[model samples]
Target: MGRGQLVRQRVLVPLFGDVRGRVISWSSAGACGFKGTRRGTPFAAQTAAGNAIRTVVDQGMQQAEVMIKGPGLGRDAALRAIRRSGILLSFIRDWKCVESRADSKRLYYGRFILAPLMKGQADTIGIAMRRALLGEIEGTCITRAKSEKIPHEYSTIIGIQESVHEILMNLKEIVLRSNLYGTRNVSICIKGPGHVTAQDIILPPSVEIVDNTQHIANLTEPINLCIELQIERNRGYRIKTPNNFQDGSYPIDAVFMPVRNANHSIHSYVNGNEKQEILFLEIWTNGSLTPKEALHDASRNLID
Candidate 1:
């Protein structure tokens, strides 16, 4: 045969089975003129699979039940081509070589189950899994103190409330710095001092102080408190600051670090009589970023 004719009639598939059984078909890259190492390459395997599938299709074989026996580079490519072909697949099996005690010969060992692929199912599952992991999961943390003095005291009780409001408001944003989700409503409930009353606590339009009762503190005694804040899961946010405090910002490690990668449940309780009073918060989310990773991202964002 001429070189061109021999190349055109290359045997892409060589089927083998029990002597008494009927042979289906098989193919290899080396048979298609790919020499030595090139025969094992993915491209060669893909081409061989494509040609073999086309031949089987022309032969009126509606479905192929394949048993893959070797650990060859072409294994995956061949399987992929089989799926891409219009032919129906009965099943695909992976046969492994395991040494047996009875005979030194290695036996084919492993079970292969038939899994039929439906249109668009893989994409749908991927989208749903991502949404559940990053969006639906929640995490939490609690901060505590006996009497955590205001960062910088203000002249009036209103001033303290406003300062606290701004500080807490910043926290809502810090939680968002992780870039996982945004919070729509930040619920803050302050239970101790009169000056830090619900009405006095002013937050952004999105935040709401769930408790409205006024527990006015007595001048003779120190104020004890349990502040509860809830951050609703949503999306990422922009950190907003007041004009006066434009130049100043909190330390990323001390503030934003705690808010990142903290999607797991966090619970804390400090007795009123105890020397230390506590602040508690719970953040929830499926595993996304680690706290350290979140901190790194937050710091990088600030620099950028």
Candidate 2:
């Protein structure tokens, strides 16, 4: 009923079978006049598949299914050759890695494979999941900063190495995780003759910094530096608004997306007589959220 291709690193072999599991025709890259390194090339595989499919077609076959196995450069090429043969592909299956993991508290990486989907469904699910992960997930970020003596963003403190504006910019790079929602205030009072980092910021009980080593600013002299930060949990980026700032406070642009990157790929497979598709998704995050947690939340958002 369907053809099978066994692909190796150095060669490809296509086998045509009948409904009763009898092999009626078979061809390989080696049999197609390819030699040495050329036998493993995609062009050689395509030629081999084309020859095998042609033999099967001459036997009065109108439709075929393909079962692909192994890792090789010729897999896709062979499939392409089958598609060009004008045979209705009722099924296609490939075996590959389903998942990998490199997860931590602050940085997360995950791979997910969704399979047995009908044609076009993988792309639809992938698009919706990516959007939900990147646009709907909420994260915490510093939205405003207040300094007692520095009245404006351009002002500089005597002992600090960075200007007020520079310090505000550096604060945006800090990654923070919080269980609580809405607005909260956190302050840092550092008497510094050294470097200041995220660890120095005094956070509330419900919040913690993802990376304690993230630099904020440097202080050359032993001067008391007191600063207040207003943090908020929201979704997506928020530009600075004049209405949110008080006299001594300056607004900072906030990025509340915990998921740093998200993308997906579609694959095809077969189950029973149905031609199906699969989705391969990858997500990377700043450790504020785990990939699994982010995927679950994103799917829930799509569902809701």
Candidate 3:
């Protein structure tokens, strides 16, 4: 290990839930392995429980691939736990097998390839995806466009939006990841269910997040931390035009502008230099950062 170099650990937890039973197998960086168990369908309650367990297991692995299986509700929660624990996941797969074939099932193949962690970058965007079918799945955040109004055909959409709430939750994750890479400082703004529970949430050593979900999370306040962002006007420059309201709608692309608090609330593009820049963030509410705070944010570039 070189001086001041940081060592990263990755861990994987197999989640099998709602199959009338469930179990967890864990392995560590240098240690052998450990196993644990929980009873029941591994439904919602089990999912929540499994999330906590996955987090504990993740803390020990330097690199991990979570192979989850079974017909259970907890699979998604397990993934969430892995993300929250700061263990960068290599992939999420369903390793369950089915007995349908006779000859084809006997075929053997060997192909090894290591995929980098880029697509998983979406993990940095954390809003719960609204889904219908209960199958092996990946999640996506709701955009007001496709998600603005629940289609007349689907009554369940209303319930989905209610549980997940609004505003993509993954922005916090995205911002945190950027900060970790010395790209952007975090300025959290969030609010939602289990408000009191937010305070208990944990974060990485250097990541910053605000839990506005009913002000549930206690946040640290630095005397002077400022985040200066350079924004570009869209080709149409109609992102959030307060003046023109003709009732007729324009393609979202037509309003290409990306600004804080534009009509498309949380939709934005973080503009900055190509190389990650180290900067401090001064978080506040009710107004923009003040003059001194702005100066501090602009002047405190750590690397010469």
Clash totals, every prediction: 27, 1, 17
The sequence of per-residue lDDT tens digits that candidate 3 reaches over residues 212-271 is 232212223222211111111111222334433222311121222111111101222343
**What TM-score goes with each of the models?**
0.27, 0.65, 0.19
For candidate 2, write residues 156-209 as lDDT tens digits. 889899998899999998899997679999998999799999999999989989
Better of 1 and 3 by TM-score: 1
Q: In candidate 3, which residue ranges exceed 4 Å CA deviation?
A: 1-38, 43-62, 96-304
Please write out the lDDT profile of model 1 over residues 1-304, one tens digit for every residue.
1000010011223242221234434456765678765865778868877866665666666655554434445667766786787656555543222221211111111111111212232233224323333333333211111123434322223323344444444333332222223432223344444444344433455433333343223222244443333343333322433332312222111122222222221123334543221111112222233322222223222211
Report each candidate's C-alpha RMSD, comma-separated, in the order given: 23.0, 16.8, 24.3
lDDT of each: 0.36, 0.78, 0.25
Q: How much is 295 displaced in model 1, in angstroms? A: 52
lDDT of 2 at 244: 77
Error of 1 at 11 (Å): 15
Residue 177 accuracy (lDDT) in model 3: 12
Candidate 2's C-alpha runs over 4 A off are 1-106, 242-244, 270-273
